[model samples]
Target: MAAVGNRLGDATSPYLLQHADNPVDWQPWDDRALALAREQNKPILLSIGYSACHWCHVMAHESFEDRDIARLMNERFINIKVDREERPDLDRIYQTAHQLLTRRPGGWPLTLVLTPEDQTPVFAGTYFPPRPRGGMPGFADILRQVDEAIREQPGAVAEQNAALRHALGKLSRAPDEGGASALGNGPLRTCRDALAASFDTVHGGFGAAPKFPHPGGIERLLRHYALTLTTDDEPDRDALHMACYSLRRMALGGLYDQVGGGFARYSVDEYWMIPHFEKMLYDNALLLGLYADAWHATGDGLYRRIVRETAAWTMAEMQHSRGGYFASLDADSEGEEGRYYLWTPDEIRGLLDDDEWALVEHRFALDEPANFEGRWHLHVQASFSESAKRLGRPRDQVVALWESARDKLYRAREQRVRPGRDDKVLTAWNGLMIAAMARAGRLLDEPTWVGSAEQALDFVTERLVDSEGRLHASWRGGRAAHQGCLEDYAFLLEGVLECLQSYWSDSRLRFAVGLADTLLARFQDEDSGGFWMTADDHEPLIQRPRPLADDSLPSGNAVALRALQRLGHLLGETRYLEAAERGLQAASGALARMPEAHASLLTALEEHLYPPEIVVIRGNMEATASWRARALKYYTPNRLVFTLPPAARPPGLLAERVAEEGAPVAWVCHGSTCRPPARTLDALDEVLDQSGGSS
Candidate 1:
């Protein structure tokens, strides 16, 4: 360790700023941190995590705040603390290394030991205790042992580093061993078979333990099922059914906050039992979109309820003072994960009458402890009718009583110590939220959600985006920094497009198209078929990251492709279409090795291709909500509905539509020519179905 002070004080990331006053000499991910260790021939100790990470905060307080640990760290290592959100490339490399090293899935507050000179990791693990208490060796002990290993057994450390690097280099542990003919029918079937093998029949989602929602997993399978169902419906529906099952499980599971309405970051157990507790804006936005689509497909009240409730939460908790959305809410409070969500039986019983309490307890199976300690996690059952029948109470009365209790408890709970609210508005996240709000507004037919979309859009446009029309990543108070990356560009573009569809505004369409052009020019990977994370003008990090992989959210390229596709359709620009097609093709080539990986990107591809229809509305569209009902009457997935604004010269459109004398109507367009504008929603429906088969 070098000293008590570090370069992290000068860092811009909120997570890094939290540690600016720490006793540990924490340096940001910069050359100075690496060069110092190389100069002193000391091993590098790298800790990577995010602001919302609970264990990251725990380890920081227990060990990094201690002077002795700081001294040990300075003496033996070039210590670096990286905010994972800011530097996802570093997070990805090390997380992959961790999973490979431990034969387990990786997560935040990741710890790793690396060679000082070559930037190669030698040893790694997650958070360790300050004094060897939590069934793990202390951080101080690990530091000493790692230092000794480097000093006494230098060869071993070097060998481990070499091996780690080699393994990371060979991305495919076993390449294309599936024996499927490249780019043919065999690959698709093979991929589908692999999907089925991992598919959970009872619970849904793929994989065994620590399952994720995996949006791309559902999107691709849904598309595959749709395409196959067109000609043959034998096993294609399996994928769709599997996706529904998993989605439903997630909706009902503790992964979703019953009270707050948004989902937690992840479930720790195999059963989606306990959550990591942080409420990320991005996760809710994605899930809302997923649930909305599910509602579209199934017409299920449960899915619709999830979408509405989630939108409500986003509007209430995640919305920023400036109108844009916040990044996340921390999972931990009082040094415990899920402290805010858990309650005791006494706490619950105090709020409810004896009969109501019994009914509620029986419904949610709240007799015993659900949380780690003796507290109960209020995961309510699917319905209270059964419990009402069991308790012989009126179903309506049972529902009313439960709602009253929820309101009372929620009010009381608000007075307690709340989790840290990261109110910094992020452009990428805001974009996703905007999309969800706008789309949900349309689906639910609520003007309030649309109002939220408008307010958020105004916030981004007024505060985050500059006069030059370029966007900044985040904003707080009067301060905003970090140049907007490709993700922000793609996501915001998607947001604006959704907004355009919501209001059917030509002005938003023009703005989105203009921004998309700018994004293409600035971030488009010239040689390859993707976009760089940052602009070409920005300073490069140690690694020049051109991310093709999707984790948690869709990769920038995937988002860009979808954005471009939507923009092209709106503007009638072949350039945008061509670029989008190229991106889609490139992404398709890399899908197999990472199926559940790029859910966002896969969702985009699924949206752009297959079972799609084009509905073109001409003339007055407001008769009998003629235009609105035409768009809203039927819930069709992936249909591009173009309401031709009253303009003779369509800005980017290649086609010409002639409206009759006065009546507003819709033209359901297929491959080339547009059908005559339909006077009623029924006529439009028939035309759309004739063009594209119904779900």
Candidate 2:
């Protein structure tokens, strides 16, 4: 094929574009590259990674850009660069092979080798430095030995390739129908312990160095904590208390953008003090939902205000032309790290009068020698109560003054040149945003946010999910491309479900359930227990990882299983529940063996084993304005509540129990059965007390 240099320059993928000038001739995943490898009898050197991956950037700059390395790659291998985001299928397949061949785990900047005739990888690894470093092999050494082995022992190479391929084949097998596959809730205790041990008691996340904010993991903990505490029959965290502790801690940490009011992708340290600097839309969306819940649980207006400000920033900055949210804002701008976000002490002082500046500085702990290496990265000084106590004023007055200060500083910061925004509108990420906004509106009682969510949802339904109910994965500059994977389906379903609950819109729930069915039919890996990350019809990836567990975001299968369980409960269908159960069975083995490794997957299992309470209110969602309003009054992340018009019947799942009787009513269903309808606000409250999913 055309070497790595020629091939990569022609592709438009941002990740691929990031490598366009690499010395290595990096061809995109196109026919010419593969064909040339076969014709020349050279091994295919496949490299896979994404733009936001810091390590990926490092490897690209080190080996891929080195002329000597490029010469070796040119002389010895057929190189191809693939963007993991645009081609997750390819990344999945090879990542699986990388794990099997190396007898180790796989991650980005995946480097692999395969027979020159075709691209079946025989050897694989993550990053390889030019020189041996950190107990790792040098790229040149790996290249020389691997190439020599292939040339000198062709038969042996073929044998190893066969062995790896066979191993991968089994790793991707469907779940057991015989129910022999072993996994369950009993051992979930180990998973919980693992999480507890790793939890940064000081910070609000798991692990130490290179810590990522496991938003999903934290939520799962909150769900459990909320349940256990309220029941009081057992001793553990119930969902509400957990929802409170974890969210409050995170919001107070440096992981949050204390000044601009959004969350960074993660904190580099366990203390949540140092960040890698990129602010992602999905992270913000998920955090927004968390903050909204925090407000509901504690009636903390501060939490509600943070949610409101975050929503404002999201719409003001991240919203795409079609109403979809953009993926991320890069960590760097003007070749300076966090330049757009960080401010000098003098800059802060310049914006306010001497007294105001002193007050602001004292409140935020800002000093002459900046907290973040001479450039201040905004963060909170103390709890509002503590600050109020210190200020000798009422809490509300203190809060009001803090807001005034933040507003003044925000206006000043807005004038600076902003960071580069990756304007790619990914469906899954956008879906998270839409759902977050909608849920915030419902949970914290914000009508303005409800309007924002409606507009964004309208845009997604119109632009991404076409008339035929098919979903597209990404939209950029008016062009939507690629077939959507499971994440797109799962996250969008989340958005629709949130909208349905917020407004009691039958059209929204009806469509959400309809699309859920479509997802079941299209993305479900029937052979396995749950869903595939990518749809079955998409082109094969380099590696096909059968979603083993969750990561930064919730797994598609996890969300899907939850969706099925909720939809089935609302519609009162055993089929949906049955599908969910089957999915649990399929996922049981790994989840039990190492549930901590897959916290999100464990969450799905939790859902199937113990589904949430589904509260369906019929009549004008406006009629039960009091009851529907009551549902919105408290924060209940684990509860699924939706409103349907009296004239509009819910699916068989929810319709069987709730009255379509042309009057205002609220029906609470749990453990797959419904409590009688509630005709008044007090009646609804009583029903909630008796049968509601509230922990």
Candidate 3:
């Protein structure tokens, strides 16, 4: 065979483009590449990863860049490179297959060899080295062996592929036991109990070292606390403590960017003193809402500050000029992990005055041993009051000095070589960020944040949708590619609904309706319930996944179900309500087995069990504003408050809720029932009290 030249130069994904110049011939995953493998009778060598992945870069430099390894791969196999972010459908299927094959969890850079005839993965592993080390096989040797085995013993490969396919098919289908009765509070309680068991009392997060934020689990704790706040349950108080303490620790730790105002991927240590150093848009977006809600729940100044700073960082760094948010910042810069974020003691001291240095050294424990690679990654070691007392200065004076030091260090860090950023705008990720911005904006009374959300929504609707109104999953360099998956539709719908609460727009509501309708038509499984990750029209892969478990992102089916429920209530649409119920029935079996793993689905179930209260306020702008503000004073996850001026005409259930020109009137509804219109502020308060609005 002739040498295959790299063909990834035209790919839209930044991860794919990163390998365009590698010594290995990297073909983007497409029909042509798969066809070539089939024609040449070679097994497909599929390497899956994203641009921000640290190990992906390492593997690329170690094996893919080596001429000898490249020759072996090119001669033996048809190599295909896929950006997991761009093709999560493929990643999900293969990652699951990897687990079934290896009996171990999967991570990137995910390596696999698949039979060319049906694209069935026969072998799987992650991050193989060029030379054998750490008891792992070398990539070149693995390639030679796999190629020889496929040619010498084709029957063995076929048998394993058949078994793997059977296992994957079983995993893809929801269990038949799901029903209305299966959706119970047992799973909810089980999830809470599981979290309690795993909760680290000394530190803040669940489990031990290599701690992820687990925003979904933290959110479940918050909502659980809110639900049981009025009850006499002591566990509710403990739930609040766990959620708030975790937020506080995360904010004050190295996992959060002390200089830049965003969160790293995860903590590499239990103390939260070292992080993986990748700043992902989704992590920051999800954390923004959590911190904002924590502020609303406790009126904590720390939570508020974290929200403000993280939001500032997002808009300044992650958001594209076109309004969509980018994917993530790389973990490495200049070929070293965390090099861009790490700092030397001399660097910090030189940038600050003596008093400011003293305050910084005391507050961040710069006086102690270095944490990451013999250098500092700032984390709060002491409170402002402690630093003030230790320095014998006023608390306010110490805060001012610390602020000055941070600003100076931040400016100095800005001058350093920065981490590479993946600039592709993904619809699903942007949706998460949009919800965060809009929710925080409404809760914190920041109009700019709401405006940012609106702008992003506009970008998605205008740029990411095709002429026929189908949504695209990704956009970059003036091109939108790939049919939108379930998450793109579901998450963006969620964002649209959130934006309506922050600042209502008739067009946005229409967009949300269109999205919901498309989801029903294209993604929903009419027979089994829930939704497939890929659309009905998407190209066939090994398996069509209907994932219910929450991973780095929430489950698409769960988000879709939740969004449908909210929209159904808002519009009084029976179709959406019925669909949501069906989705719950579909996920019931999974919920019963391990509810802690499916926090998002449990959230949807919570709303199903206790239907959300919908409050519609109509009057002059000034009057409605006051009423809306009062209604949202408390953190009510199960309550939605929408305010409209008298001139505004809302659709569906809201159209019936009308007000006179000057009088401020409110209608409060729980599930299918609505209270009589309240003519005055006092009457509105009375109705809310009756409905347990604050609860």
**Best lDDT goes to which candidate?**
3
lDDT of 1 by residue, 342-458 (tens): 888778789777776777678668876566577777665647678778777788887777777667777777877888877778888889889988888877788799889988988
Using Cα atoms with residue i matched to residue i, what is each candidate's TM-score against the true structure? 0.87, 0.88, 0.98
Please give the lDDT score at residue 478 for candidate 2. 61
lDDT of 3: 0.90
Candidate 1 TM-score over all chains jointly = 0.87
Model 3: residues with Cα > 4 Å off, grouped in runs: 178-181, 230-235
Better of 1 and 3 by TM-score: 3
Q: Comparing candidate 1 with candidate 2, which one achieves the higher TM-score?
A: 2
Quality of model 2 by C-alpha lDDT: 0.73
RMSD of 2: 3.5
lDDT of each: 0.73, 0.73, 0.90
Give one digit per residue, the lDDT tens place, for model 2 in 1-695: 44435556545467777788877877877778788888888888888987666667678778888899889988898888887666656776787777677778888789888786657787889988988999998998899888888899989888887777777767767645553355456645666677787766655566777777777666666656554544447746443444465576667767777778788877766666668787888889888987776676668866887798799889888886557787777776665667777877778778776545655676677764566767777666667777677767787876677777778888887888877677777778878888899888877677877777777777777777776788887666666767788888888887877877777666787678767888778777676567777766776543455675776677777777777777777677776778777777787776766777776666666666566777777775557667676665554556777776666655565555455455777777666566777887788888776653343
Error of 1 at 137 (Å): 4.2
Clashes of each: 7, 32, 0
